[model samples]
Target: MPIWGWPMTEILFFFEVVLAGLLAGTMYSLVALGFVLIYKASATFNFAQGAMVFFAVLSFVGFMELGLPFVLAFLVTILLMIAVGYATERLVIEPLTGQSEDTMLMATIGLAFVLQGLAQAVWGVEVRRLDLGIPDFPIPWLADNLGIFVSALDVTAGVVAGVLIIVLSLLFRFTKMGLGLRAVADDPGAAASIGIPLKNIMLLVWSTAGIVALVTGMMWGARAGVQFALVDLALKALPVLIIGGFSSIPGAIVGGLIIGVVEKTLEVYVGPYFGGGIEGWAPYVLAILFLLWRPEGLFGEKIIRRV
Candidate 1:
């Protein structure tokens, strides 16, 4: 009954906790993916990313409450996000195009508050349920065979996250538009010189980021409910990005899984030793430690400068 100097039950419990953490990490990666997309296509930090998650889920659930079917509600939410992106590009990003980075950062912070207030005003401050038809029950087969308990909801989210990452990778690799996005990310001036419309490209990038926000919102909302707290869930993505790399999609996935697993496992195992509540600060501490070692992140490019 002993395994690796630990009881078999203890080992099984550890595996179960790790599995749960991996699933939760997918949600973090989904949120961080939005930040990566926006920051990659444009140099903006997108302080509004988390707010967008709150708004998107609120809108989707609101639409569902109005008798719209899930599919219809989802499509409508997409269109709304596209409009939000266009308005953002036109009214915020474009006007401040040549401004300092600090100026853009402030604008996004303002946008975040604006979005949070607007969503509350429109949808009310009450929490709402979001059902994507993914059950909250554990899969009996997995639990019975492997002594691991995993939520069906978490499994669905993980699959969706994986599919999205793969689809995005293919899009960036094979599409002309995707190539243009890469060019803009590399050098906006050079891309503009080659006849790629910088304005249009930026718009495309924002809208795409909007889509990412929507996906993050749906997953987080399903797990935590459609509410203000979902906005805070976006903060988890920051550490994930710090661990992975700001501009690398693969980094987002890996970093998110790491944060998710580490935080959850620490909370369950080591939390009591620290008087509980270790989940909140554990990821940040880990990220800070990793950053001290490598500022650019695990998948991010190395910065080399000659003085």
Candidate 2:
């Protein structure tokens, strides 16, 4: 026991847990980023993002199995996702332009099932391992010098996610295309009135979202072997989006961190009392509380309507 009435070792362990949780939260943020991108551009909740993640990584694994080099496989997968994006815009969204939100949402729900089945048919229902060449073990120096353990893979993930967020932020903040995207996100009719190409912008946004899905899939598949269950990971992101807000990128990142920290801490300290699965559902409970307290989320914009 120390001056704080807790063991020094316990305090160190608590810090370690928090660091690990924040790192893990980056993965959740990556997934939520996909949702934010699409929602920002189209104001539609893309229910098929998880399926896109599953298909992208599954395709990457399949290509590798067929003797493609790692880099080649990744390039091919990116191309495929781009094509998927194109097809989605041309075949699905184009035909249903001006549809109600519920209709578009139902379309995405159907799209999810279709993508899942298509991936299954093409890649088969076998779980495959993805190795990104990053070691998943603890950094020996940290453990030896500071008595805290952190995974190299989690660190790599955090760095990748941070870089991605920065790049996206830059793209949205300082580019001609970014201006067009922002204009469309704000109001499609007004954007088109100013000569912005709505269809082209939507295509670009969806394609970018597909690319985001690919990055998300690669990270997640590397951690938890590629399988159908990975689709459920999207459900985990729902809590993240709800807590963070469906349309705010920063909200996604912060919400994911909060969920990760809360889940890990609760699972560690309070789990033993409740039989140990608190991590699975605690974030959702927190999300519900957020819904009750701040329906638009911490960073979400409140909508105003005149009757």
Candidate 3:
């Protein structure tokens, strides 16, 4: 019962694959949340989110290169990302107010290019290492006792993503700003009528998305190195959005984990039989299948229009 010349059918190996998939899925959900947050607030897709990940990582790495400590670089990068969010809201979103969603989305596409150019201009297109103080080695006890191959980096990333999800869940459930965001998502005009401050809410959402992008960049960059390719990883979020729904946070999380598990399992167990390289298409196929079953996604609400 050897698969791909390896004993992957073993129960321990199955658990190992599941753990790896979960970690990968957490990273995907981290990126996918950027889309969910923005779409929920403004009803416009932020195509620039992936670009923002690159910019944040590049900026953070640049700061680190300037002799700043990791904590200082990270905090400064967050402030700068917030500033970028504010600028994007004022310069791109504000002027495009009242425009169609298509127009606003186009603006975001342009913003993506602008951000990419800025990163290249400032960071000189060099792929730089991003060390977030996480060790790259695996835990010896887990590896030896459980026969599970887990990277410490993956564990660190999973813990960070879990903490982030908890913090955001708390913020959304217990904060006035979160209330405003929910109100805006329900109905912007109604939210505005109730003094929810639509503009401010949008700004806050964008800032929050920017922060998510920063964290995504740090974790992914620490794993893959900071470079333009990081933006490609961001594209994986699109399938996540499709599978999870455009506006559901929990959907993003669930969809990400599903995608991660499906793709990893396919690559590890099935790809060998099919000549390999199934990781890229497997998630999309899984998403298409899910859509056929539930068009609105696992946690997404179905809309019923009045005829």
Candidate 4:
């Protein structure tokens, strides 16, 4: 019998659901960041990003299974991802320079299949657990005091995502390389004319995207187990990218939070009417609505076509 007409426990539970959704959305933003970096730099959609995530985590788990220490394995995986990025830029993207966007996209799609096959060949198709030593249980003080349950791992993820977004924002806003990247993204021909080195910038962008994929893979793998199905997680980022704008990092973060909150709230409050599973499709539905109304997204620049 609360003054608001809802039970105190129910109100606490609603807040808990929203918090959980926000945390989950952070991970979604991490994945979308990879797509944003590549698209911002090269205007390439990078269809293979999901496969890259799958490969990165599978490779890390395989390395760990080979008796490598956790830290060593992580370092090794970073190096491996960097190498993969370099190879992709040189072999797949460079060859198709100046080609139609469809051609470049097709190349990445092919690369995705190649990476997926290579990972399965090397590590097999078995699902594997990735224990990062973060506890997944609820925080004691919050549960005891406020009756709100939240996972320590989710909190850690939110913090990690926040730090990453801040670092990237600084990197893109304050550094010489950031300026060069912005120039290249705006017009590669002009950037190259001014000695910006388009190839090198693209290489750096792809490399950074690979590192992002690795981080995303680790977080998702730790939560859901490392498996081929992890590739599908990238699909979840599509709605985020659409809502946040594919070229905006901060937009990605905000879009993720919106999706997360809506998904969780709908699943809890409105799911019973539909017999549950509302969370699975709710984000996409919202994304579609955004597409119809705001195709450029909240922070995206509006395209101006000159006749």
* Candidate no. 2 TM-score: 0.97
- The alpha-carbon lDDT assigned to residue 126 of candidate 3 equals 76
Ten contiguous residues with the weakest lDDT in model 3: 3-12
Off-target runs (Cα >4 Å) in candidate 3 are: 1-9, 305-307
Candidate 1: the clashing residue pairs are none
Better of 3 and 4 by TM-score: 4
Ranking by TM-score: 2, 1, 4, 3
Query: Model-by-model lDDT, in order?
Result: 0.89, 0.89, 0.87, 0.88
How far does residue 118 in candidate 4 sit from its true spot (Å)? 1.5
lDDT of 2 by residue, 1-307 (tens): 6647988988998998899789878889988999899998888889999999998999999999999999999899999998999899898887987898899999999999999999999889989999999888899999899998998888888888888888888998899988999899889889999999998888888888888899999888888889998899777888999988888888989988888888888988999999998888888899999899988987888966668
Model 1 bad stretches (over 4 Å): 304-307
Worst 10 residues of 1 by lDDT: 298-307
Worst 10 residues of 2 by lDDT: 298-307
- The predicted structure with the larger lDDT, 1 or 3, is 1
Model 1 vs. true fold: TM: 0.96
Task: Work out the TM-score per prediction.
Answer: 0.96, 0.97, 0.93, 0.96
Candidate 4's displacement at residue 93, Å, is 1.3
Per-residue alpha-carbon lDDT of candidate 4 for residues 1-307, written as tens digits (9 for 90 to 100): 6647988878877888999899999988888888888988888888888899999989999999999999899899989988899899899988887888899889998999999999999999999999999978899998899788888888888888888889888998999988899998888888999899887888788888888888889889989999988887777888998999988999889998888888888988899999999777888999999999999887777856678
CA shift at 275, candidate 1, in angstroms?
1.3
In angstroms, the error of model 3 at 128 is 0.7
